[model samples]
Target: MHAAVVHSFDELPRYDTIDVPVARTPDEVVVDVLAAGLHPRVRSGADGTHYTSEGTLPMVPGVDGVGRTPDGGLVYFVASDDAPGTMAARALVDRRRSITLPVDTDPVAVAAAMNPGMSSWVALRRRVGFQPGGSVLVLGATGNAGQLAVQIARHLGASRVIGAGRDAQHLELVDALGADEVVSLDGDDAGDRLGRAAGDVDVVVDYLWGRPTEQAMKAVLMARTDRSRPLAWVQVGSMAGPEIALPSFLLRAANLSVLGSGQGSVTTAGIVAELPALAALVASGVLTVDALAVPLADVEHAWTRPVRPGQRLVLVP
Candidate 1:
């Protein structure tokens, strides 16, 4: 079998022949990988930067993909944390972790959308318990996940979706993706712009948690006109920076609740439970993703290429 093998953490994965993974337990089944996404998480794992990285050498680098079983059953699966991942021609997948896909579904789109789509879907549905018709503000709304967050928030019944990002061109597309308003984070008044947008929003799905987040929090604290309405600030990713200097007054002054929704915060079962609905949405075209499929043989060059915001590079084996 062939795979994107990571011999060293400092470099890109080499496309070479590797031994096929075998099922180690009765619950595990070997599947032929059809398509795997080159997500930020996968890139971080290959670079030994992600917190979940195992630090093992000579291993496959993908975390999840779309594949087919020996019986020709198509499925979307999440690979084991420490096992050879989904980048290879053959991978051992735990049966329980795999979800059956519809026959007409686009495998590459599902492979690309699942992880990014899940970031907001799970956060809005499971973590914050978001109610329909509420207002939402998506921080860092230019990235792939953030783009999907804007759409998901609107689909889940957000009356008004506000998208905030640093890119000007990409920010223009957010309104088409269901964001009622968009704000730029590049200027010095970025905080004030975000604060003005944060007025009375019910849920804030934050992906960038650095100075942008600090400014947004301050803006929300100052601009919120209603004290009775509850506000849920769900932190999903820290693309900007990890830490923020949050003032004590921001929490004390308003009905704001800050919480994180990933890995430890949301259970594995909880994350998996939301996939079927998201997959169905993708299949039905209710949820759309911009993905480019690259051959597995081109992993080295494709890995280093610059990816535009809202576009995902998928590897087809």
Candidate 2:
């Protein structure tokens, strides 16, 4: 199988050939590569910066993909925890964890959308216990995860969904993605912008954890006018940076619940269990992914480019 192999952490990946392995377990399936999602995590893995250094040398880097099995079954997978990912001519995954795809599904869109889509899906549905006719506020709304969060909220019947980002251009695009309100993180008065846009959010999904995130956390905590409930804040990623300090008083006083959500601690079985319902959502068209497709040969460039908000880069592996 042809793949982009990373030999060293600080170096670029080189195209190479490797043997494709057969599935040893009945639950595992071998797939013919089609397309895979290129996220910052891929680049981080290639560069030895992704959370941990488990991805040793001679590894293929990609988190999720959409493709066909050796048996010609179409499938899509979110490889958030499965490393040596799907950036190759072939890859293997547990059949129980795979999402069988429609015969005519677009791999580029599905592959690119899978990871971020899953982030929002699991966070909103599982972590926050999202319900119909609720409200959601997405911090870093222009980023890939944030943008999908907006769509997912609306798809799940969020009465009001707000997109909070740093730019106008991305804000407009997020609005089109189904955000009832768009707030800028780069304006003169961002807090005011957020306050004016979404009056009082029921839930907040935070991706950035630096100053922007800190402010957002503070805003929601301090706002006495917002709708009060069992307020839940799900923190998925820290694009701005890690090491955020939270106010204990606000959290305790407001009965705010801040839960850290990610794929590392989540089991493959959990993902498998959710695949069916998620696939149904995908098939229904209520949820759509925003992606940028690139050739596998150009994986290097994709790694080098600054990731655009809500832009999932799919590689034709």
The candidate that wins on lDDT is 1
Instruction: Report each candidate's C-alpha RMSD, comma-separated, in the order given.
Output: 1.2, 2.2
Q: What 10-residue stretch in candidate 1 is worst by lDDT?
A: 220-229
Error of 1 at 140 (Å): 0.7
Q: Estimate every model's Cα lDDT from 0 to 1.
A: 0.88, 0.76
Error of 2 at 149 (Å): 1.2
- Which regions of candidate 2 deviate over 4 angstroms? 79-83, 196-199, 226-228, 306-308
lDDT string for model 2 (225-294, tens) is 7445567788888889886877677766675788877765566677567666776666666576766777
Residue pairs with backbone overlap in model 2: 143-310, 144-310
Q: lDDT for model 2, please.
A: 0.76
TM-score (all chains, Cα) for each model: 0.97, 0.91
Enumerate clash totals for all models, in the order shown: 0, 2
Per-residue alpha-carbon lDDT of candidate 1 for residues 1-317, written as tens digits (9 for 90 to 100): 99999999988899999888888889899998999999988988899998887688887889899999999999999888757978878888888888999877898999999989988999999998889989999999999999999999989998999999999999988878888999998988887878788778999999999888988788776887886578999998999898999888777788889899877788778777888999999878887699999999999998988888999999999
